[model samples]
Target: MDTLTLQSTIRMNNGVEIPRFGLGTFQSKAGEETYNAVRWALEMGYRHIDTAALYGNEEDVGRAIADSGIPREEIFLVTKVWNDDQGYESTLRALEASLRHLKTDYVDLYLIHWPVKGLRHETWKAMVEIYKQGKARAVGVSNYTIRHLEELLSNTELVPAANQIEFSPFLYRKALLEYCVQHGIVVEAYSPLARAQKLEDPRLTAMAQKYGKTPAQIALRWALQHDLVVIPKSVRKERILENASIFDFELSAEDMAEMDTWNEDYWTISESYNPECSPRWE
Candidate 1:
């Protein structure tokens, strides 16, 4: 298989280069916890960092980025707007708020956190406007299903450049991934290590043993081998460094195939698209 690096990038539908490995700020609460994790990740060579308005850590993330001294252009900054901010006006205001909190004038990628029922079109319109205004280099969505993708494709002139979803070996989205490949949208795995749940999986553990790496590394390698972007979060400095070290080793095709056959039930997080989820569009 081809190799990957912290410097490697996946092109978006809009033709922007996004780092293959990103630092996830999900659940990274505000204050020193998030500020420290982001600082450590950047110090350890992570150029891509993902955050959302709902994470409530944008200010902390902004602090880390400001202090890291890494050139803003060298790092790929991506953040999303939550469902509550799903209207054209709300999205516009939210983007400005995110920018203020992140302490950056432009984000590398701005995404619609989820596809809401009545206001997704309006939300998307605002996102396209953000992109045109140079506030966001590219715009996309998260937790969007194929059905949701089709809606945007058929109804709008602007196409999403990427889709952020909970993807890992336990939740291999083969069908949606195939569709994305055919449609020019890049699929980014948010909970790439299943939020570190696969730290004890037999298949992952065995592969880690064979490679003398951590189970997390094996899982991340599985995603990288498929050419998908993987954002794994960790507050521990060592773990942050370990996750970025995935580029040094390659998982064999045989092992990759075996891991693929492990199972296909990995969406532990309930998304807005879940029919069971009562609409939370505010």
Candidate 2:
């Protein structure tokens, strides 16, 4: 297979194209920090920027995009509506706020940030309307488990253009990935580095030594080779550059198979992070 580059794109079900690699602004602060990080990522050749209303960094993200001198069309800007904003009229209002904060007339992609139980399908209905109005080039979801996706597919008219999930070799959701692929939905891997928690695993360490690359790069390459769009988050200049370097290398089938064995369905537990509460996994 040919080596993938930073500029490689995958077309969504809506015919909107998204970059295969992107910089994620999750915990990035909404000021000079977020602004500088985004500016640096764009300067370093990143064409995709993923942020959300929950991140509280939309204003800075928008500022960086405006100052970058790159035309808005050239960048695939993605943002999401938070769980609290997940109802019919509320979602429409949220998208307008996101666009206002993003300082753009339209967003490349808009997502329902999480599957908030009774609100999931209803939120999707509103998103579909937003798509119809061309406010969002494409609409999708994040943190949706397979059961949640099934419920959504059964009710919604338009299939989601993509599904963003927490994916890495350690937390690999193979079955969910397969299901999305079968249904013509692009699977985007957020937190693709596993929050840098398992980067020092013996296997990843060995691969890093053998390949002369960092363990994080090995992890990102694993996600990309699985045909998943990867949005690895980092605010540091060097780490951002390191994450972007994975495109030059391709993992072999044998190596990928070995990486598959690393899966433990690991979940990052935090006092504030509740997947069941927010995403409602089955």
Candidate 3:
């Protein structure tokens, strides 16, 4: 963990290398806000950028990358197929639309944004096809639970290269993380800081003081130390810089265990929107 830098990457199952830390553009607005945020992140040495068709910022993200003057292959770009576009044919069409918006012929990684009930299997089939055709270097899923993963594995010969999930000290998903690891699927953590909902907690703040870092850094560092790829979102230049300045320190083993106790199954997304709680997942 001490040797990790902003440039460090984890190799996916398909031999694609993904930067372990990245910028998340979930709620980042579609225009200049998303564009500048991505530009700042790239300037700060972030090579991976996570966006989606649902985010409505792929063009902004693409423009920022193109304008950054960085070679396209140097940046590990990721985008997702939204729930509404989950069928096999529509999934293929969705990636094409996303590519047109991102202004790229291929994505470093492509994901099914959600496990849209009854459509996820077909969606996975399309994802496999995309991967085979080189449209995506690797294909995976997001917001998937253990059951969903089990169902996917049981039905498909190809294992997902990664699984993006909402993970943090405040929403520790130990079982899910372990399950992914056992299956050789990398876990990418979104909302790694729990959307700042618990950043002000006394325990987290105290740890931040102990490490001379911000609570957000502590949370992101924890995720990194756990070997999870973490993408924390921020639009402000200062915050973007702050989020990337997490590699200089390491949390003690005792403190890591203490933070693990902070989990309450908390979620920033409402119950109706939380994928874990959706009846469709059953």
Q: Which candidate has the top score in lDDT?
A: 3
In model 2, the Cα lDDT at residue 52 comes to 97
List candidate 3 stretches off by more than 4 Å. Answer: none
Greater-TM-score candidate between 2 and 3: 3
Error of 3 at 203 (Å): 0.6
Per-residue lDDT tens digits for candidate 3, residues 1-282, read 449999999988888899999999999999999999999999889999999999999999999999999999999999999989999999999999999999999999999998888999999999999999999999999999998999999999999999999999988999999999999999999999889889999999999999999999999999999999999999999999999998889999999999889999999877876777778666
lDDT of each: 0.88, 0.90, 0.94
How would you encode candidate 2's per-residue C-alpha lDDT over 101-206 as one tens digit per residue? 9999999999999888677777899999999999999999988777778888999789999999888999888999999998889999988888999998899999
The TM-score obtained by model 2 is 0.96
How far residue 21's Cα lies from its native spot in candidate 2, in Å, is: 0.3
Ranking by TM-score: 3, 2, 1
What digit string (tens of lDDT, one per residue) describes model 1 on residues 240-270? 9988888888887888898888766666776
Query: Against the hidden reference, what TM-scores do the models get?
Result: 0.95, 0.96, 0.98
List clashing residue pairs in candidate 2. Answer: none
- C-alpha RMSD (angstroms) for model 3: 0.9
